[model samples]
Target chain A: MIWRLAFATMLVLAAADKRSGYQDASPETRAMQDDDASNPGFLWVQQGETLWAERTGNAGRSCADCHASIRGVAARYPVFDARLGRPITLAQRIQQCRVERQGAGPLAPDSDALLGLTAYVGLQSRGMPIQVSIDGPARPFYEAGKALFETRQGQFNLSCAQCHDGLAGQRLAGSVIPQGHPNGYPEYRLEWQGMGSLERRIRNCMIGVRAEPFAADSPELADLELYLGWRANGLDVETPAVRP
Target chain B: MMRRRFLVLTGSGLIVPLAPMHPARATPVQVAALIAELVGDATLRDERVKLDLPVMVENGNSVGMTVSVDAALGDVRSIDVFAEGNPLPHVLRVRFGPRAGAPRIATRIRLATSQTVTAVAKLADGSCWRDRVDLLVTLAACID
Candidate 1:
């Protein structure tokens, strides 16, 4: 009972401290992230730029043909699509475009090509604040994500809020925990040694907590991502961010 | 007291030369030997190269790092990186051409434990410049 009460107090304290992951990074990491020439994440961005103009599928139309400049497009992801009657992540939207508009086959969830395009599109929104709506059609999914964030389902009996919200900045097994935000992704993680989507990072966290992670591109993960977007509303998009 | 001082001085001199024979827990001597092997017979001057890494890292699995050499070094032939504590000490080796721009490279690398990371630059002049930083890695990477 005492442990539960202490955790509750930590949660309240964490909610009051709204800090971005960037604030927790060391000076050298910050320098690598701020400079384009020194940031390796730009390598994937370059690949994405090439894929943006390549024509594919039966329609023989490239992404550029539909959206001339994708600048600021990623900032509004996890948006409510009236046609789909639900919320969808940027990855889901890309798949939708491929299958419906471009008449191309769906790229694998963790494919290099998919990551390239996602990184490319997300780069356009770099430095822009995320603005996801939780009202109107996006309401139900947003609430579900919030529930998931608060519920403790893992073997460790830890919720996302328990660590990200309550225990952020505290050392866990020798590493500092930052406020879990989804501002920068398709991020370049040093552990993965490559660019990965937000969903992939989420899966890592799930595994860390001994929880059964949702499969890539699962609606649950997308919804959880939407909640993270809302949670990190004002944080600037740092797509292709370098993370340890 | 004068005779004792002489004996102490002689004793210290002997220990200094024999220190390399018995490697300490975290000695730079091993790291230096590794760098010597990479740039055989070349004089490694401790100048110009800058290795940027965090002093304290929470997760050793994916540490962001950058290596930049002074453009004044004229022309750099190659840049090699090593993490002494990793199973494979060699991390990355990047070669540059004559027209290669600035000698700056950045990437993420894994650290098996707390150890010194070394960066060596072989210049066009056949001279080698090196820099090393001792980092405190909390949770090691590549352990799975």
Candidate 2:
């Protein structure tokens, strides 16, 4: 009972201390993300800005033609899709809109064009607190995501919670692990040498643990994205964040 | 430490053997030679310049760098940056205008490995000043 209570107390404290990765990042990295001139991620944003206005597909429609009021749109992502009856990540939403709505070809998962668009759209919600709901139809996916977050797998027999939740701010080899918040995504990682989506980073982690990574368009990743989004609730969206 | 040599023809039609340039990146000797070529017969000093880079870097992909000079900021005409362990040693060059303010620039560069990053500032009179910082770069943890 005492151990359970101690764990519960720790949970309460951890919940209250929901810090974004930016808060944990070094000052140099912070400066890079803070300054548009120095941050390399802005290069992707620039590409995205170009793509937004360019007409494409059989419909020859542009993203700028339709989604004019996209401010704060990225913050409320991994939202419940009524047609799909499941949660859809922002990237998936863009893919869906590009194909079905705009009559365009499906962009390859994690492509620069796709990442550029993601970064571009995500930039609209910068400084806006993440606001996703786990209510009603979204609850089941959220539960699945929560389960996956806590599930132990791979050769290391580690769960996302073990390191991200329990050992955050602590050193693992040469890296200081953050809480695995998905706030700053399509972020420029020094390791990646380019911008990458949250899904790609998630898959990277899965592979890091020697586990089978979920498919790019897999429902599991969407579920996981939902969970991470929920976990990172209230943190400002830091699109195109620079990370070491 | 590793190097590859190359031959260059002088303007007077004389072939001269320059310092060894690494097959992939620039070695210290090659970088020094490049700096010498840029400075020509002008005086080169180890003062009036500052190279700001992290002493230890986690990854070599994108390292932020800041270069500055002493009080003679306005007369500074240009600055050249060289990385000792990158595929290309001369990473960046910034030429300042007459109306340019304090001689300071912040930029990001990719390092191939752990090595010294050198920056040289050329004044209007052709005199050059420099500073260098040696940084240790470690590999990434999430090696997927």
Candidate 3:
């Protein structure tokens, strides 16, 4: 159960040079992200705002009842939980509270309800730096994530690192390869024509490479998220980020 | 309606010979017929009006569009926008009053696929000016 492999030594990203996917998007896209009225992601944020006040389930409570505010909470996501004994993403944390504290049935992953709350909470951390912990119990998961990111897979046999790391700025066809940062998640991907979680984005890449995607609720996703959060340490969270 | 005079101008011989049964998915023939309907007997000129939209669109869901006509083209009457390939060919129409300032309209439209979007500007003098833009949707790299 002990992970003996150490990946920190091999990977040396110049955190200073870490550029957000926002910097690589088109001008029109940047404008869309900048304009709150035009940003479709705000739709989810608005939905979350409503859900925050509406009481649900046996507890007859709203998210507002316990957590008065969501500000700065998203910046510390994919956190190591003592009870769960594993790292959980911001989205999962929301569901955990809904099911346990609010007594609401678990919302389906990638559903509007879940995405709405995630986008809402993530918005509070807009411009705040990502700061996921990789120490102690979170370390094993982080290392696992690092291994997955660097491993070759799928019909194309491409690794996430081979593109996002080795060729971050290079053109893959027309699009400049993004460093694959998760800073802007529950993002409004023009391709999807709606909001999507980090899991959808990662699975999409796997599918793009003709590789099998992990399950929507896979622990591997959380592990990957932990690693990505650690990698994007100082990058600002642009939740509900407009992406082409 | 005054728009029906176009049917008379084209004569019964070229009145499409078919009704728009498929209200969705505007065909090239339907687009031409609709343009004719808007044009009436007036000739559709190809100058002094502009329809601006991105050539290579990232997605078809919400493509930004702008339509403008030259102020020198006389008192503006109306500017009608159309997409040759959308479910509804008549995307939007902006009617201008005598006091309306600039003859321009900027908004977004969804493209069902690659096609030409045209903007027809009608002056109060009955002269019609028009512009068109062809666009391609880039969509996504991975998902099919």
- Candidate 2 residue spans exceeding 4 A from truth: A1-13, B1-44, B71-78, B93-104, B122-126
Tell me the TM-score of chain B in each candidate: 0.71, 0.79, 0.77
Put down candidate 1 lDDT per residue, A1-244, tens digits, no spaces.
3664476456544544666677776666676678999777888888878878989888898999989788898988889889878889998898998988888999999678888889999999999988878998798999999889888866566678777776667755444577888888998766576778889888877765557989887889978988888887877899978766
Q: Scored by CA lDDT, what does every candidate get? A: 0.76, 0.82, 0.81
Candidate 1 residue spans exceeding 4 A from truth: A1-16, B1-53, B58-83, B90-110, B117-132, B140-144
Q: Each model's TM-score?
A: 0.76, 0.83, 0.83
Lowest-sum lDDT 10-residue window in model 1 chain A: A8-17
RMSD of 1: 11.8
Error of 3 at A37 (Å): 0.7
Better of 1 and 2 by DockQ: 2
DockQ, candidate 2, comes to 0.25
Candidate 1 vs candidate 3: the TM-score winner is 3
Every model's DockQ, to 2 decimals?
Answer: 0.15, 0.25, 0.16
> lDDT score of model 1?
0.76
Tens digits of per-residue lDDT for model 3, A1-244: 0111222223344677788999988777888999999899999999988998889989999999998877888988889998989999998999999999999999899899899999999999999998888999999999999889888788667678766776667665446678889999999987677899999989877766657998987998899989889988899999989988
List all candidate RMSDs to the true structure: 11.8, 10.2, 11.0
B44 Cα displacement, candidate 1 (Å):
8.7
User: For residues B54-78, could you state the per-residue lDDT of candidate 2 as single tens digits?
Assistant: 9878767778889998856568888
Query: Over the full model, what C-alpha lDDT does candidate 3 score relative to the true structure?
Result: 0.81
Candidate 3 matches the true fold with a TM-score of: 0.83
Question: How many clashes does the backbone of model 2 have?
Answer: 0
